[model samples]
Target: MSDKKFELSRRNALIGLGTVGLASAGAGVGTSAYFSDEESFEDNTLTAGELDLFVDYWTGANSEAIDGGTTGSGQNDGGVSAQYVLNDVKPGDSGKLVFCPKIVDNPAWLWAGSSGFTQYENDLTEPEAEVDDTGGDPGAGNGELADNIQVTVAYCEPSDDLEGSDPSGPEDFETVRELNNPEDYTLTDLLLELQYGYLLDGYVEEGGEWVPTDDGAYPASPDSDTQTGPCICIEWNVPTTVGNVIQSDSVEFDLGFYAEQERHNENPTSPYATGTTDDLYPPFDSNRALGMSIQGSGGSGSAEAEIHNATSGNTAFPFGNANDDSDNFPADQDVDFTATLDVDSNTASLEVLGSQAGGTDVTASDTDVTDGQGDGNALGSDTEWQNGGIPQTVDVAISARSLNSDTTTVKNLTLNGTSVSPDQLAASAGPEQTYLVLQGIDSSAGNTIEIDGTLNIEGDASGWSGIDGLVINWR
Candidate 1:
């Protein structure tokens, strides 16, 4: 995994002699091809021409062209730049590019070759560590670039229906039929497949032997009609959804396009493939290196923490003493409301001394007690509302633990006026069904809470029991 560069120029691509090497084989990008032909003795005196391949470039839009000239021992047909070079890429930076492999003198079977892939993490920084989730060893070549740059390789077909195809009208074959298809691969995956003679090559093992897969492959580019063949297009992107995990990272590799005479030839896999391509395809493994990145600078921001004391003021009630209280502040309640309720075990310190066995004595009193319902009529048997006039229905809640028995009863215990739910009373167990329960009671007026219950314990007490917590939400 040494640092390598796959820089290929038109000048170098035209020299096809020793180009059969792979990226790992030392050279950058070059095509590897060999064709077979038979002599036709029909014409004694004959004119012959070597089969050749020329590649032209279009920036996905078919708006501009870069003639790579003849990629076989021919000089440049110079217009602008003949090859693509991506630099200073950023998130959301994406588009497609087209490559037209123009065959001359003869139609040729072609195979796309890519090899010598390398990825570098570059100088890791704090910004990168903040978002990077690769969990790989630092300072290693396990960068995130290749995995973040998604690549969609598909054969283009001319159509007037694709968006922005009017420039070439019906003859524009640049519509990416399946650019964002579910089977799209990242750059690393795509390159790995191409190097192994698998992707879009039309040749795969069938019936226990290597054979041609007629579909999912580009037909041979004909020598007779240059404009007829479909263009091989690639749609690349560091998707907008990608984040800073790829920051300060980079990758390099060689994109090799190969070709051979189509006559009497069927299986044209990559030239650099060794042993068999079957072991690497059908289902790719998970050993992948891909991610997105961003360089340079921008603005910044920061954050800190603070503290508060709920000892006094609006949040100071049981709120300061009891964080579990559901009571609200004076301002939070109705302006006409002027009443207060105090019910805290440790704070109130109320104790009722009664007989150890069967007895009907469990009477307790608090500052304010409505019939646990919203009907706020204040006085008839209990105290009067400190404010005045007849009030509205008052909603009440209680959290208490009383020592008693299972058959305990509290008269007029209507939790809310229509309190018919068994959930209104919950218990903590004693020695043999003896209990510490919570129940509501009503006063002479239908709206006062009287805590009067009769205990019916028939056995010894003292057991492990206590209600953990309770919360009843009104839906």
Candidate 2:
């Protein structure tokens, strides 16, 4: 045999010799590096790490207000507020709230004639007045202003640790989130999971007739027909743990209105018009627009604590958009919304980066002999090893086949596997298919691999021993 001795570093020797009988060497290894044999090594090592969950803003529901001042032709600027009781949130955790508004109806007028016939009016002026002023019956005129409907959402999470006693008091109001400007906000990833609907409501008349009323109640006639409002539903994501709670967020909706008279100018002599008079009647057409707002808050609550169980594998919760019946709003009038939490830890995927020779095979090893077989062929097999311990080191021969097409340019290589170190790996420019030397084996008393530096593999066209016994772990 050639007198040339393989220069094995202290790290590699310890790692190679440490494979005495450990059975936890399969936790971080990948299937690609499995042994030539079909049998697999069963590993049972547990690792400790932190996880993060994300939440986003979304729209809820919308309803129309038919009350006196809340109807068509009238300006409605009313809102409702309620307190949400979180059962398990802890101090320091953060949360957010979002709100959205939708137009449930358009502004219009309905007229009842003396002949007991109903007529629909598009103008803000009376038909008889239009005829008297123009010498011929004219169509209704447009109203002074369009629909002026506005909606706002405000949230707070106060703490008793502060200078106040009442959590809901103004002094205690923390102002966690707000949705006053829908034009400036963007929706988060969680909010894009569901669909939303738009709606409009207004008044309509049957016929064009006018009757003098003894009482001067602005036309004095009741509407011939009343239009109902539409409904919308929203969906979003939420979290069940302390870390995720800080990422909880929300969305708000806002419906906009435009002046009907402005739009009517395009149709100066619309079919609905009777003559060329400015006397328009009630029931003018008001254009509706939909608006949206997204916001978030940061605070702790009882709800966070109840959901995050250290011992339990599950840590996710869900919430529905149904309103409390005691709130006095009709069930149909409430917005329909849904919230979900993504707590499955397995959903997270890992990636490793490094370069390997085409003919080289990465092997797996066990530190404890009692936990693993003696032969070095335990690539896919399980071996006993400590958590975060070094299980194996790779030794390969650099050759022409392993080099890139240029043969001189060092190619950035990537090794994909779990618990891999150097997290990233690379190879330098040299010859083709030559035995390249790779050293360093994590032999810390524990089975975990402590990788801190890079390993170089170099050779000529003749090629060298690609790699000998390599070790890895899988979970």
Candidate 3:
């Protein structure tokens, strides 16, 4: 590790260069008899360590009216504690609020834009808007900003964080991340797009004409880069077409600023020459960036979308309040939690069966059924007996295979949502199979049967863990 202490300078002078030869000449006879020694010393001084980052709201063209102008202070400035807020903001409101991130004591490298930054959206789409420059007309090429709310960033003078206009001079700002084209953005894309080396209206004078340049992007540096400024101006916007589905919607985020040694940027580690334990132990050091949370509440009279179940799939049980009515549900309510099972009579038969007793093959006799019940291979020759058509003697076979060393209990069976306790289901312990039979059934269309019970799982159950809702439909 390098020294982190601040050092003071000590001055010393050497003035005996020519005297060395003269002194030796006179003492040539006995060199050691007239021995003389002179010593020169220099001090090694170190500088103090520094890494700091901060985020604050920038009141455009006026620093005194930062936080609603009540006391002319932004959050965390002086005694003010209220964070930056954008209220009653509808769509198409551009440049509503401007903020700046400041770094000092060390050079800061930042990551921004949709590619690197992430904002949680509660799984809903963000509001979309047209580029503010398009004059509210989204027909312009690459004009649409997919999210209902959008944030655009530009480099600005470090000393003045309140500027609303883009940087005009080459020395005004440094780009850390580049913004994405408006058309390529999604509703969930990062609100703030910071494109390195790309500027908003960024240009330079060459001869008589202004040539475009990468807006705020520049190389990383250990010391502050004088060619560009240290602060970035951030803006937010809402378009007019954003509907009420976003009503009462909100957005919160943390802006990050990172600082690392410039040495890493110049000579980074590669696969061939990865660092040793000592070199990689400390990882990298950086100061924490101060964060600010800005919240925007949607307008009143917000509408909601309706929820509907699939028409063809298994029936979906109601989730708490989602089944209350057919209209809209609150955006912040829990909707679904029930387990589902969909069964069709066409493929509801258990085609696989086996039986064992005392380590002997007993399936041949135990799995077959005579009259109604049997012990060995008790499945009757007639397979469609359980099919509900004209009410007749229906032989319903039940088989249980125990995967572990403990007995499993087949709780209760239900037919048409009504309990039928006489049909018992149980699997013996340790690879043992048990069978039961039902003799009467009107298995027909609209008749539903299900095993409504829990499996008493033993130390280990490889085949069947348990069943909560196992249903078979006869349609």
Compare the candidates by TM-score and give the number of the best one.
Answer: 1
Candidate 1 local lDDT, 1-475, one digit each (tens): 1122433222201111111221111111334444445854343443443455555545421221113311111111212233344434556666565555555544455555654465656555567778664435333445667767777777664454556443232234544334222222577556544543432433333453434445423344344235334556667776777776677665656555555565565434346342212321222111111100000000000000000100111111211122322221111111110112222210101112222222111211222222221122211112223333223333222221222223211122233234332323332321011112222222222343222211121111221011111111100
Identify the runs in model 1 with alpha carbons over 4 angstroms from their true place.
Answer: 1-43, 46-49, 60-83, 133-140, 157-173, 179-184, 198-225, 276-475
TM-score of 1: 0.39
RMSD of each: 30.3, 36.4, 28.9
Q: Can you write out model 3's per-residue Cα lDDT over 30-101, one digit (the tens) per residue?
A: 121233346533343444444433334333212221223211123221122323333334444443233343
TM-score for each candidate, following the candidate numbering: 0.39, 0.14, 0.30
lDDT score for residue 351 of model 2: 13
lDDT of prediction 3:
0.27
Runs in model 2 lying further than 4 Å from the true structure: 1-227, 237-475
lDDT of 2 by residue, 1-475 (tens): 0111111111100100000010000011223322333465545344432111111112122111111111011112221122122222222322222221112222212111010011112222343233223221112111100001112224333333665442222233333334232211112211110111111112122342222222211121122122121111111122222121111111121222111221124311111211113222111111111000000010111001011111111111111111211211111111111111111211111111121211111111222333232222221112222233323432211111222122221122222223322232232322122212223333324233222222232332221111110111121
| Candidate 2 TM-score to native | 0.14
C-alpha lDDT values of all predictions: 0.33, 0.19, 0.27
User: Cα miss at 326, model 1 (Å)?
Assistant: 43
Higher-lDDT candidate of 1 and 2: 1
Clashes of 2: 111
